[model samples]
Target chain A: MSDALYHDAILALAKDRRHAGRLDAPTHSHTSDNPLCGDRVTIDIERASDGTVRRIGHFVRGCVLCQAAAAALAASVEGRGPAAFAAAESALARVLAGQNDPENGVWAAFLPVARHTSRLDCVRLPLVAAKPVFEA
Target chain B: MTQALRSQFPILTPSLAYLDSAATAQMPLAVLDAVRAFETSSRANVKRGVHRLAEAATDAYAAARSDVAAYLGVPPSEIVFTSGCTAALNLVAHSFGALMKPGDAVLLSALEHHSNLVPWQMLAARSGIELRFLDVDAEGRIDLSALETKLDARVKLVSLAHVSNVTGSVLDVASVVATAAKVGARVLLDGAQRAPHGPLDLKTLGVDFYAFGGHKVFAPHGVGVLWARRELLDAMPPFLGGGEMIAQVELAHSTWAAAPAKFEAGTPPIGAAIGLGAACRWLGTLPWAEIAATEARLCQRLLDGLAATPGVRVLGPQSLQARAPVVSFALEGTHPHDICQIMDSAGVALRGGHHCAQPLHKRFDLAGTTRASLALYSDDSDIDAFFAGLSKVRKILL
Candidate 1:
C-alpha cells in the first residue's frame, strides 16, 4: 500500500539497465558482495588517456534499489572522470544521510532512500564499488 | 475453532499478511494472557522457596512442564527445557556427544539449518570425529537411496531437520529411522519448523531426541524443549553445571540432579514456559485435518500463481506431497533481499537470505531466496496479496 520507497523513476532506471553484462579486459573490474543481504555487484571501467571514463560495464544481482543505483551511475559515468566520481560519492553519501548538499549532482534519484534508511546499503554498495576505478 | 483461531492471533489484522511462520509464529491471545497471569499472580522463583507464593509458582511451573510433556506425548521427566532450539541442539551435542569416541562419525543431512549443523560441527571438530552428509535431491528431499552407502558401524548418530527451514520439505523420518537402525545409530529430529504445523506425536516417532523452539509454535520467546528417550537422558552427562542441576554440592565435588533438571541449569524462562504450555493447549483445540487442508489450499494457490508467472521458480517440491506450508522461491535475477523489501513495502511480511541455511543455498547454487511460510491463520487472500506484491517485483526490477 505504501510504495513510497520504490518510485517510478527509480523502477524505470532499474528496468532498462544500461552498461550491463561484463567488460572484457577492462582497465579495472571489481566485484563487491554485500554479505548482509548476499547482494553482489561488479563494476568494470575503461579510462581514456585524458583521465576520463571511456566505457563502463556492470553486473549487478540484487534489489531494485541497488540495481537502480548501479544503472544510474552506469548510464551517465562514461564522460565523467575519477574526479567526478570522487565528488559524487561524497555528495551521494551526504544526500543519503538526509542532508541537502549543492555539490550532490547526478545522485538526486537516490535521495528518496534518505528517508527510508534500511535500503541505504542496498543503494550505496554498488555505487561504492563503481567509484575510483581509475587513477588520477 | 477455525473462526475463533483467527481472532486469537491478535497480530492478524486487516492490512498485514504474515507469511513467515517458519521463523517464529505470532502469539495468540491465549498465550499472551497466560504469560501475563503467571507474571501477575504466580510470580516467584520455582522449587526453592517454601513460602506460599513460591510454592504456587513452583506448582504453576511444574504444571506447565506437565502440559507440554503431555502435548508431546511424553512424561514430564523426559523433556529438558533450554533457552531455545539452538540451546537444545547444543545441549544434545554436548551431553549425547560425550558418549562418542574419536573416529566415530555423526551423520547429518545437507538441508540442515545452521542450528542443527554448527553445534555438531563444533563437537566433531573438538572430539576428532568425522562428519557425513546425506545429499538432498533436485526436488529438495533427502535422497534415501544413497543411505546404504552412507550408513555403517562408524556412523554413531543421524541428525536431520524434520521439515527444512528454507525448502519446507518434510523429511521421511520413518525411512530415516529404519535406515539408521541398521547401523545402530541414534536419530535426532530438529522439529522447530514442525512444531507449529500441527500436533506432533514424538512417542510414536521413537526418535532418541526431538528438538523444537517455543516461539515457533505461538509461544513466547526465550524458551525451547529437548525431548529425549528417558534412558538416553539418564545416561548422558549434564550439559551445564549450575545452581539447579546439582544434587549434593561440596567444595570439592558434587553429584548431578535427574535427567530433566540436570540439563536446565540456573533460573529458566518461567513465564515463557507457561506461555508455551498455553500455546500447546491452544494448538490442541484445532483439528489437524483442518490445519492440513488449509495449508494445502493456501500452498497450492501460491505455488500455482508462482508457477504460471514468468521468471519465477519455486524451490523445493512444487506440489504439496512431501512439503510443509513453508515455501521458498527465487525470481530470475532478483535478489531475495530486494524481493523482501518490495514485499514489505506492500505489507506482505516474508523472510529473505539464506534463512540460516547457507550451505543449502550453496547447494542450490543460489546466494539466497525469498521465503513465505504459512501459519494456520493464513488464508487465500494472504496468498493473493503476496502474489500481487510479487508480480510488481519483476516489473519494478527488470
Candidate 2:
C-alpha cells in the first residue's frame, strides 16, 4: 500500500467503526505501558476454536499515534487464522519500520500505522498479546 | 567587580534571553576556565600525594569545599560533597536508617519531590518507622496547620523541600524548622530547587541538614553538597568507608576521620567541585535582587496570561506572591504531552509530564500538567512568546 492510501485508510478506520471487523468472539485482554509518556494500550484478542486469532481489538489510552495504531491493528487481522496471524505480525513489523508491503501473504491492515515508527509498538499491542496463543 | 565578573563568564551576551536559569543556569566563563585550567595545568590525586601537582590538586579541592560552605552560610566542617542532590538525600536516608530504631516516625510534607520522599520511605520500610505526610492546601502550599497536628514526640525526622519543584511554592523554612524543633526531630531541607534562585543561609534557616545540586546552579554536573550540623555529622556513622575516610585500620578494628572527610570516602569530583565554587562566586556578583524581581515579573505575566486564556487551568497559587517562576497548567480536554509537542513545534520549550512529583498530581487528582519555568534572564518577550504559542496550541488542539 502507498503512504497516502495507508494514511487515508487509517484515518477513515479511526473515524468509522463499521470498517473495524466484527467483535463477535470472546475476548481476553491485557495492557502494556510506555513509561516515558505514561501511554498505555489494552489489547483484546478473540481466538478461534483451534486457538487461531479470529480477531484482534485494542483500546488505546494514549496519544494520537497510539490510537491510530490500535484502530489500524483491529482492522488488519479480522479474518486471519493462526498462519495468517503470523504473516500479519511480520507485516506489522515491516510496516512499523516504514515498509508498506505485506510479507508472507498477509495484507497490510496496519499500513497507516507504519508511517510512524515510534508508535509501532502501540499498533502491535494486539499482535503482541496474541503471540502466546499462536506459540502454544 | 561587575566588569571583571562579566568578562569572566562568556554567556553574558546581549542577544540570548537566558531565562531558563531556574532549570539550569548558564555556566560562567570562570567555571569553564577553572575546569579547563585544572584539566590542563594541574591534574593529580588529592589528599595522598606529596608532590607539587598533587599538593595543588588537594588544595584546590579543599578550597572548593570551603567556598561551598561559605556560599551556603555553613562552616567548612559541615559540608559533605556528594554526587548530586539525589545522592545526598540517599546518604542521609541510609545513614539515618542505620541509627533509627523501630517505632520511630518520619514526617514529610506533601510538596516534597520524589527524591525527598522515596528515601524516607525506604528508611521507614527498613527501620519500621511510621511515615506520615503533611497535606497541602488548594493553593498547593503545604498545610502547616495539618503539619502541627501530625508532628509529635515519636517523629524522629522531618524531610521537606525548601521549594516545591512543581508548584514553585517557597516553603516557610523558619516555621518548619521551629515545628521540628519542638519535637526534637532532625530536619532535612532539599535545596536543589532553591539554591539556584537566591542566597541560602543555613545558620539562620536552622535546618539540621540541607542538600543541593551543582548542575542546577551554573556549575558542572556530578557535584552536590550535603550540609549537616557538626554534632549530627559526628553522631551519624560513616555512609561510605574506603581508603581516605578512615583514620586508622587494624585487623580487629578501624577508626574514621572527622565529619566531612568521613563521608567522602574515595577520590571525589575534583574538577566539578572547583567549577561549582567558581559558579558560586560568579553568582554572588550578579544582581540577585534584580534577578529575583525580573523572574517574579515574568512569572506574574505568565500567570496572568495563562489565567486569561480560555480553557487553561493554572495549577498552583493564582498569584506570584509566594511562588517561584515555575507555572504549571492544564488545558481543557487536552493531554499535556500533546501540548508539549505543539509548543515545541512553536519553538517554545516547556516540560509536560508528572514533573517527577506524581504524589502531588495524585493529591490534586490530575493525570499530568504542562509546566513553563522561568529563570533570571527571562523577560517580557519570553512570556509573550509562550502565551502566543499556547494560544496557537489551544486553537489547534482544542
Candidate 3:
C-alpha cells in the first residue's frame, strides 16, 4: 500500500530536480510553510508581458511528495497563463479530494497521496506557494 | 512478563509496535476501568454541593490528589491538578512569574520543548523580565557547564526539562539544584518525559516545582500534576480565578482559597484527575528496578541498531548511562515524514518532525528527526519490528 505512494515515477520526479532552484530576477516569488511539520516550498516565476509563466523554479525543504509535486507543477506550468495554471491546480485538487480518478493525468503519480489525507497538504504545498503569483 | 504486561493494554495489537510513548502512552485496562467507574457512578461537581454524589466526587478527587502526592513523595495539599503539563507550566509562568520584577531572569535550556520555552517567552513579553537560555552540547544534552555563567542573584528561576523529549537525556538534577540553591533561585522541572519511566521522589530530587501530564503516564488526557513546595505554593498567587477558589465574594473584591484550591478555578477535570491518581496507584505496583533493566536493554539495542544503519545519526546521548528509552535519529538525505510514513506501513508506529523541540533541531542543522520512544509494555518484538521497518524505510525513502 505504501509502495503506491512512493512509486518510481514520483521518486524520479523528485530526484530529477530539473526545476528545483531559484530564477534570477523572477517576476513573482512566494514561499509557504506547513507549520505542522516545518516543511517549506518556495516558488519563483518569471512571467511574460501577457501574464503567462515564461520560466518557473521551485525550492523545497520538505518530504518527497512535496518535492515531487513542486517538480511536476514546475514542469507543467511552462509557457502557461494564469487560467491554465488555475485549471491544472483544480485538476490536482480534484485528485487530492478524491472527486477525480487518480489515473487521470499529470497528477496521477500522487494517487496514493489521496488516501493519506494528512499528506494532502504535502502534495499541495507547492501549488499553494505558486497560487499567489497567478492571483497577483 | 512482557506478554503479561502487554495483555493489560487493550489497544496493543499483536502486529502493532506502538513506539510513540513520549507523545502519549497506551492506557491500561485498570486506568480505563477506574475512569469508567468514576463517570458512571460518582458523577457530580466537587467542592461545593452537599448532596451524596458531590460528597463521593469530592472524596474521590481528594483521594486522587493523595495518590498523586504519594507517588511524588509530597504532601497532598501541595498537588495542583491542571488540564495538562502545558497548562501546569503556564500556571507557574503566570502565577510565580507575577512575583518577578522587570530585568529578573529565568534560565532555561536550548533542549526545552515549546511548552517549557513559550511560557517563559510569554512571561518575558508580559513583564519586562529577561529570558536566558543554556546552550545544548554536541550530543543534545543541556550544557550544565554554562549554568554558572547564566545564573546570578538576578536570576529568580531555573526551569528545564527533566528529560529531553527529543534526546531522552536525563538532566543532572543534583548539579542543577545545587547550583541554583547558591543563587537563591527556584527550579521547575518539566517531568512530562520522566514520569512515565517510573515513580519519582520529587522531594528527594529537590526541585521546587515539577509538572507532568497524565496522558503520557497511561492515564486519561485533560489531567496533569503540578507539585510545588508548600512555601512556594503559598507565596504564589492564584493562576485562574472563579468559583471554588474563593473564600468570600464581594462586589469590589474576593478573598482567595488556600494553595491547591486557589489555583483550581471553577470545576476541574474530575474524572481525568481520578484516572491520574489511579494511574499512580497502578504504577506503584510495578517492580521499577526490573522494568529499568528491560528498558535499558531495549534502549541499548535500539542505539546499536541505529548505529549500524548507514547515514543514521542519533540526536541524543549515544549510551544508556543516564538516558531513557526514547530514541531519535536523523537519516541523511531523507526527510523524517517519509521515513515515518514508510515505517507506518510495516505496522511500526514512529513519530517524526521536531518533537516540539525545534530549537534543538535547528542547532543540529536539520528540519526534523524520526523518534521511537519505549514504554514499560514495549517488548523485543517492538524493537524487531523497528529494525525491520527501518530496512523498508531505507529502501523506500533513502
Best by lDDT: 3
* Fraction of the true interface contacts (Cα pairs closer than 8 Å across chains) found in each model: 0.50, 0.07, 0.63
Interface RMSD of 2: 6.5
Candidate 1's residue-wise lDDT over B208-314, tens digit each? 89999999999999999999999999999999898789998999998999979999899989999989988888888778898789988888888888899888877
Return the number of clashes found in candidate 3. Answer: 0
Arrange candidates, best TM-score first: 3, 1, 2
Which CAPRI level is candidate 3? medium
**i-RMS for every candidate:** 2.4, 6.5, 1.1
lDDT of 3: 0.92
Q: Model 3, B116-197: lDDT tens per residue?
A: 9999999999899999999999888999998988999999999999999999999999999999999999999999999999
Which residue pairs collide in model 2, if any?
A: B9-B29
lDDT of 2 by residue, B1-398 (tens): 33343445476454333334445666777789988998788788889999998999998888888888878887888999898889999989988667888988888877788889988888877778889999888988888887788888898888988888888888888888898889898889899888888778889888888999998887999999899999889989988888689999999889999889899989888899989888777777778887787778778888888888888887789887778887888888776765665565555667776777878877887767888887555566666768777786766555
Question: What value does the lDDT take at residue B382 in candidate 1?
Answer: 84
lDDT of each: 0.85, 0.74, 0.92
Where is model 1 more than 4 Å wrong at Cα?
A12-32, A42-58, A71-93, A114-118, A127-136, B249-254
- Sort order, DockQ high to low: 3, 1, 2
**Stretches > 4 Å off in candidate 2:** A1-26, A52-59, A78-136, B1-23, B251-253
Best by DockQ: 3
lDDT, residue B305, candidate 3: 92
